[model samples]
Target: MVGGYVRKSKAKGSSNVSYSVTCATCDEVNILSHREVGGLTLPLLHSSHLYRVHDVHRTSITATLLSHMFSQSQGRAVKQQLRFYSSANMSVNLEGNIFVTGTNRGIGLELVKQLAEKTGKEAHIYACCREPEGTSAEALRGLATQYPGKITIIRLDMSDEDSILTAVQAVSEQIQTAGLNLLINNAAINKPDSLAQLSATGKKDMMEVYETNVAGPFLLAKLFHTLLQTAAEGHTSEGDKMSCRRAAIINISTIISSIEKCPETFAQAKMYPYRTSKAALNMLTRCQAEDFKIQNILVTAIHPGWVRTDMGGEQAPLITQDSVHGMLNVISSLSNKDSGMLLDWQGEKIPW
Candidate 1:
């Protein structure tokens, strides 16, 4: 199903009439032309087209059409009027405050970089990392400089609760009453451990991984809960007709976290610590999704795919740019229905 409306084109030419229809289901935007409807009025044509193509119809199509006709008859210009409905692409509101953790390198750095490029001044992105002066962190700092006020580099050590609180406070002061719109829990650590090597040393390594990958995100979400709730309230106040308008938390989990798809041979490869921590992180995502439903915050776990990072090494199938790009697309398309699901970079649901 799709809904469409006609608006006066702001383009230089008066004859330029642009009509946009977005699918109510997928939210994919389709730019329509008069040629496509062969002179039929846009509303009537679109109503019939949606019914025939998507089997979806809105009862207000007639009212909308009459209203548009009335405006034309009155010799008044119709400004852009929008009716909100849930759609995959429509869920992404880029003009909001977004925070990304572990922005020094790899996927985190790429995500910050791409987001800055995509949203420009429309978004305020807080890029957080442990060491602000490190080489990779310097690169992120350069991006912040390039984008100026759009990006702020905050010091955040995922293992340190005080550091996390400081970062949250910094974001709060910057965004003020606007609140935090999205939190990307991208900070994580991976340590390889085998069952055969299960000893005190291996246990310590596993605990460290758990602290960074699971506990850190859990605590960050807890500390930022109020900001997220405030953002949700602001979204609702906008009177967007969308069924759900919630702030979002994206946990950067991995496909390796899936216990259901784990093969015996792969499971014994001495990567137990990394796998177990991500699995725990996935569980945390599910718990947060259920717990935050009351506040209308959408929490999701996503696998960014095996990309060519320091962790993924040379033979990795995807590159950081491609992986981050896909992940952003998936993130932009998220609805409340997707909360708590373990999804891939491409937005496909993954096994538990």
Candidate 2:
């Protein structure tokens, strides 16, 4: 429960603020040497308290910085004040590259907004959509304008192999070698369908849905695998617990896709194509986790719940903000033990 930062006096004849943190375990002060004032959250060795560790330029997290940021309550939700502090303008040293799909609207847009709002200026975000300059991406454009270089909007079409390749190459160029820390396969599609609607064209509808929801994620993971691997290997310690601190791939999956729980959920809706494709996506998540774990990359599937969004009808109980808020927290706390599992926005495990 002990947390807060103090502003030290300005350096002689310098405009930059002199920032320091008193190690909670031993009051050993660590001065933040940066071009300007910024902050990062750190729990130093033998400390029961949380301290903010800030720097304008963050070299790396697992190398010489605070190896872990969790408090004693690792299993519990992070305190409200900490979350607020992170979302505030104060810089957090999450200096890594992140790529997200379907950035135009809905959950993808919310993810991009929250990521931009939460992480520090050091984090580079590539917001990918089918039409980066098209009319649909105006809000995304606004975000790019608002945050300046913090986010880069890239053109991506989940269903198209060539477009995905071009996006990968562009993103790889922007990020230094082995620096893609997070990849979120959040882009997806859903259309009206039922078993009764499964005519020849309905079958084609199923294939189309599969192309975007299942195949897109699969291809992205395959192409980005080595970059993700290199990022993980740079950590230099396999003992480091799996987190976004390590390279991570978060596949935005759904609860309706759970085969064991389908009987309980079937009465709600019967969108055949959407349901089947997500089921396939879940399998992809499991397969990726198995393949990537040894390389120190963390992969998992998250169900954002039936939120009130373009795809999730207005009648749904959850809102986009709350769902994304919980999801970001869950993602931050993931360890190797949780890899390959299906988890909810609150970090609760779901039956595959």
Candidate 3:
């Protein structure tokens, strides 16, 4: 027998009472409202009947029920699955910092993982991607579970100005709690083409790439400059008059952008768009670094080495983790004395 207890609902001026029925099976209780039982009665009569759903809610419910069916008791359980996930690429954790960007599958994704795993320092990695539900982001969710309170995922497409603005607003809200320290510009892309092919595509793709890779980082830095400065000003170090070390901006760049070290192979390969965009980025890094000099913000461009991510491709020499580790070594070794200098992964200054 399906033994149960029914709780009658209390409503004013209503005789059609609402009741919740609790059924015990093997000493485990399952609760359902009378209305719910009524709906199920038809399914019991027609064994072929199946409930259908239209969207994510249905999918989540199905997955949740399947999980619960295997459990010993009909107890309510909060799903351990992550709704969102992210990683802030970091090598070593000097302090708890906030990192944000899109397209985490390549360099961006690797950076976030290394930051959390290698640094042994607390990090709040805000990793945004074009599709939060995409398979590429699933590994990130796993990372979030591995390190609770360490990562967050959001939808961010740098090409979309509104999304960029929204990401900044969210970061502003988070900084109130954890306090942001380093803002790393790690997300970048290149439209594969020669100068001849680029000319055919005209100014459109060029501007789009620049908007995402160059302008977006500049705007993000500008919006958070005050917050970063404030956070930095709160901490103090030995041999420092100020209460805190100034916040730092690490602008991820490419060696192809270096005018002094431009490889002949790159030009022959026709990677003009990628190279020029980063060159512009390097200049912007210089400008911002100088602008915030008095405010105690250290900004510099860094060549992370040729890494073997999607952008770097299989032929690229350096591993993503190795490149990031080298870069972190440079960052950790930096003194106020080294501010504003363009550096390579090895910590040597790159000629502007």
Q: Which candidate is the best by lDDT?
A: 2
Q: Model 1, which residues run further than 4 Å from truth?
A: 1-93, 192-201, 237-246, 264-269
lDDT of 2 at 89: 36
Candidate 1 lDDT at 6 equals: 39
Deviation (Å) of 124 in candidate 3 = 2.2
Instruction: Determine the C-alpha RMSD for candidate 2 after optimal superposition of all C-alphas.
Output: 14.4
> Which pairs clash in the backbone of model 1?
none
lDDT by residue (230-349, candidate 1, tens digit) is 888887764422212248899998877888767732533347777888999999999999998777788999998766677766444456766787788788778878888999876879
- Model 2 Cα lDDT, one tens digit per residue, 1-352: 2232333445668776544543333344446553332223321211122222432233111112222323222222222221222232333334488899998998889888888988876688899999888999999999999999899999999999999999999888877585788999999987653323444336678888999999999999999888887788778775656777679999999888889878767666667888899999999999998998878788899998667787776545456766777788788888899899999876878897
After superposing candidate 2, which stretches have Cα over 4 Å from the reference? 1-95, 193-201, 238-240
Q: Which one wins by TM-score: 2 or 3? A: 2
Give the Cα error of residue 55 in candidate 2, in Å: 37
lDDT per residue as tens, model 3, 1-352: 1333333353578554343333233332334343443322221111121111112222111001222222423233322211111123433535666565753576677666766675543556777777778887887777777877777776777777788788878877877744567778877777754344645555666787798889888878887787777766666453232211237788888767877766533543456667788889999988887787776667878887656677665544455655666677676666566666678776868776
> Candidate 1: global Cα-lDDT?
0.71
**Ten-residue segment with the worst summed lDDT in candidate 1?**
45-54
